[model samples]
Target: MEIKHNPQLTSTELATLWNTYMADSMGRCILTHFKQTVEDQYIAEIIDTALQIAKNHIDTITELFHEEKIPIPQGFGVNDLNNNAPRLFGDLFYLRYIEHMGRTGLTTYALAKAISSRKDIRELYKLWYNQTEKMFDMAIDLALENGTLVKPPYIDYPKEVQFVENDKFLGHFFGKKRSLLAIEITHLGTNIEVCNVGQTILLGFSQVANSNELRQFFYRGAKIGKKQISTFLGILKDNNTSYPSTWDSLITDSLESPFSDKLMLFQANLLSAIAMADYGTAIGGSVRKDIGVIYARLMAELANYAEDGAKYMIKERWLEKPPQTHDRYKLINRKD
Candidate 1:
């Protein structure tokens, strides 16, 4: 992709580039480990593709930052990776992880493209978004072939076009409620799967974390994720709808840390942030008042979890500050 000369990057463009750089850098470290640890040839190929994409994004973002005279973030790298550590996740988990990440990348890059005014930046995001779409398709295809993908529950086809006749369709507080709407079921099933993934990842992190404090934090996160999964699952059970299978059983008993404490903490917090966003989306898509209420409550818990993780990162000096405007008040107070 050729870069056209333009004015200084807009705040939204800078924010999106900086965020993508940080995520991809961290992803590079994690994917490097996955590529090294994976045994299956087909899975290894997918991991390699993901790792290359991460590295390419990091390089492109660094180049853009240099051109714009913005300092690059000190994102994760070889120093934060443990090449000798044993694998913490099973081969199947790698596929699932890639699929999940690719799914997220599509959303992130689409939004980045939408908010960007610079032609070069918009094109970059569009390119990456397409790449992610292909990557996600690959993962999904393989998962389907392996019979590892847990699909959303199917609902009977509507026999005819029907209109709501009563306000009760919105759900009731005391009496018999209506069956789950397709959108409601979709969000509930998706959130349950995300929680399961978070729970398993945190469980692996907790086992290998070096600091006791970090270990406890990861354990607590895993426990909360497990509870959230159960809550969603219970809702599905009420409708007799099936949900995705849990990934906890796929975690290994490895005690050796594959990633630094800082990296692990960042990843855990990132997952929590994603969960909160997912819940908010769910709340919006849902029509049932009770379902929305449940999502709202979960969002609050996830917010607290993410905040604590941010504080911990700050305390440890592991959090890298993003680009921001100069403080006008500080400038005004300057004596020189």
Candidate 2:
């Protein structure tokens, strides 16, 4: 129950404790989507993989708990599921959800590995991290295969741009000129548009979800996306850049559709995950620490939301089985 950064604990104990907690958390989240429908076989397979990973971790942790005389933590159950949840989004969104969850999972497990002192725990984290990486890669492959993943416009390298430095109350502001701002602003606008589209899918799904809990989850996510959009807009404003008016107009034409609730949730999760990665990269490229900090926070928040959503979908049995790798040699030999 009480986990400390205690030096006294054994490696197995630590790994068991951490994994048990995570497994239970993930299980609870996934169980929410049990009995929900999936439109795509590939997406469904990926969801299954996500579920398998959660279930595997839970099983492992449960065994460890029993061996250690520690009571097994209660995992996710039918009680946590919303079988009657209404359809809130289309099928395209479900694929996006798997993609996002994979990215978030990779980042999270990597972080856990870095902080883990125990060798066994580190190895376990490594396994999960690798699994997440594979999941992300597969999602990308699937997206490319399906022609759904959006690629940002490529810009040729430009040399020598005039950047201005302005001193203000809080801090000194320094950035590229108005013309460059225009370019950056344009890209930011594109990201915002993608984000809005994803959020719309989620909102539509939440509106129809039969379970109040699932509905609330999607509603909360919509609010988060709105707040993030506003934050991004404020960043543009501070830089004397015009925010895109397109986000407001890119509304979903229909909230009710043939899409299952699980699929809708999946799509929403994927979009948010992609946004997190894109925004994080954007922040890293910015020269200003303040701006970077803002973007970083946004990325973290989005990752959290994606993870939460993925957990619920898995619990509800809406996820698909992930592709497995046979040998390292096979992977190395595969054509790019």
Per-residue alpha-carbon lDDT of model 2 for 1-336, expressed as tens digits?
444543444554465455445444444354235216565677777767766677776676667557656555443345435455443444555556556556556766776778776665677778877877776787688878877775443444658884456533223336442332334555466566556665665576576666677879888888887777777666676666556553332224443443346645655665676677678667655555566677777788888888888888789976543323358997889999
Best by TM-score: 1
Instruction: List where candidate 1 sits over 4 angstroms from the true fold.
Output: 1-4
- For all predictions, the C-alpha RMSD in Å is 1.8, 13.5
Model 2, stretches more than 4 Å misplaced?
Answer: 1-36, 69-71, 84-87, 158-221, 230-285, 289-336
TM-score of 1: 0.96
Clash totals in order:
0, 32
In order, candidate lDDTs are 0.88, 0.61
Could you say which candidate leads in lDDT? Answer: 1
Residue pairs with backbone overlap in model 1: none
